[model samples]
Target: MLETINRFLQKWMLLIAPSAVILGVTIFSWLSSYSYLVKWVFAFISFVSCLGLNIRSIRKAVMRPFPIIVCLVLLQLIMPSLAYGIANVFFANDPYIIMGFVLAYIIPTGVVSLMWVSTYNGNRALTLTIVLINTLLSPLLVPYLLHFFIGTQVSMDTYGLMIGLFWMIVAPSILGVLVTRFLKEKINKTASFLSPFSKFALIFVILVNGAVVAPYFRSFDGTVILIAVLVFIIACIGFIMGFFTARIFKWEKGVVLSIMYNTGMRNNGAGAALAVAFFPPSAAFPIVTAILFQQFLASIFGRLANYYFHVMRRRIDRRQNGLTGI
Candidate 1:
């Protein structure tokens, strides 16, 4: 049952995760609560998750970042603006609901999604680079995008968000990478243990976000679902647009898949964090929906990359040369 349950959650967004987050947020808001537990838990998970990277990988990525950099630029700037334009067409008059749409629109790439890219053999370095660059630049690009598009009502603290993102996301990743590198001989024996903790923490963060956001659903005026639809549409557009862009560049399958994953997956965790700090409670609904869209399509992309890109194509090429293959 445990294994089966785990599979289901893996397949269904760590099952009940978004639900739990919605529930937690609702309770927190109702009781006037801001749990350090929730924040630290997410921050810790985000930290430990990135603990396996090294400066070597970072530098290598930096040297050869054209494809990834272009994708990151599109994801951080153009796509968010596109989401906003579509959203404005629907959410023009209502400021609070537009808040939800606008908040979800401007946030950049996610780190966790890069894990999915790696697990399924979809250009790990490229995906990791996108996450790193977008995050590091979020201090500037995120605020600029938000200001240019939405203009106000957002608590624009570029420094705070950057510092918070670094502490919560980038710094932890650097530390994690260092630990894995310097202590490889010692930690290698027990590194497998980190997976369970990381998975649990990720689900916990999702649940907390859900719980915190649930309060707004009670009085939601239908705009929440509309914004959710908007997020879905934008995510799908990202997937398709990325594929075409990769085709234009004549990238290999790995590069193409990398772009697809980067474009499609927004950082819902970061989005939620921003929502809580910068906007009203109801402003987080689109971000909440984004968690679902990101997790689901990312999983599907991972599976496809694993089976088709890694396994099947290898088999096809091997047969052409009369050799056995993966």
Candidate 2:
């Protein structure tokens, strides 16, 4: 039974980080309405789960940084505009409504994308490279991306936004890097024991975001449907493209899963915060929902990828053993 659990985790590790947050949030939120303690505890847990990404053997990761850049540029700068341009044709009548749709595109990469990517024994170093660069570049790129593309709805207070972003993205990145550098060898020793609860941390974030959006869902009439459709489209596109891109390059399962997280995950935490800080509450709704939906869908996709990878490995092993007479 214990071996079975270990096998399950190894197969689904990358995907489980986010699941931990989503599921944790659901369980905690239900267990406590008056206890503010639970939320803060889980929030820190969520942050730590993501924080693990910055711990790097950086020297090893820098060898091939090109794919990392391409993904960041494509996702941060190009994708939102693509969504806006496409959604415009469909949502021209209600531009603000469409702005909700564009919210998904304007969002940046998930730092936690690196963490889960690590779970699959993915290109942790590569993911760290992309996430760190994307996060640092986000302040300049995110605002400009919104201004040029969906600037009509999402506004940026340059000083306020930059400063706010620094605390959230930069500060976290630095602290995480520090932790990983100093604590890596130590933490790795206990990683096996602590990994299960890591799922709770990731799942907590998603469920909390979902609960946050649940209230907003009541306020808006058609926002949920529009945001859902647009995000779901990008999620599908990101997942499909990521897999093929990995296959085309003949990347290992880890690299493929890392890219999947990079492509499919959105920096909705940053996006939603900007929406609230810079715009009205209405603008934040879609951004919030986008986070939940992307995580949920990506989790499903991650499972499928894990299953296929395991099955494929067995086939190759059988062939090598001459068991199948290949």
The top-ranked prediction according to TM-score is: 1
Tens-place lDDT digits, model 1, residues 1-326? 44455445555563455555555656544422553354466666666656555556667767877897679767877787787778778878766556666667566666666666666666777777777677666667766767777677555666776676666666666666678777876664344556556567766666666666676665666666666677788877887787678868978887787888788777677677767665666667778777767766677655654555567577877798785433
lDDT of each: 0.67, 0.61
Candidate 2 lDDT by residue in tens digits, 58-77 = 55666676677666766775
Query: For model 1, where is the 10-residue window of minimal lDDT?
Result: 27-36
TM-score of each: 0.81, 0.71
**Which 10-residue span in candidate 2 carries the lowest summed lDDT?**
31-40
Q: Residue 76 deviation, candidate 1, in Å?
A: 0.9
Reference-based TM-score, model 2: 0.71
- Flag regions of model 2 displaced more than 4 Å: 1-56, 93-97, 151-155, 179-216, 219-223, 310-326
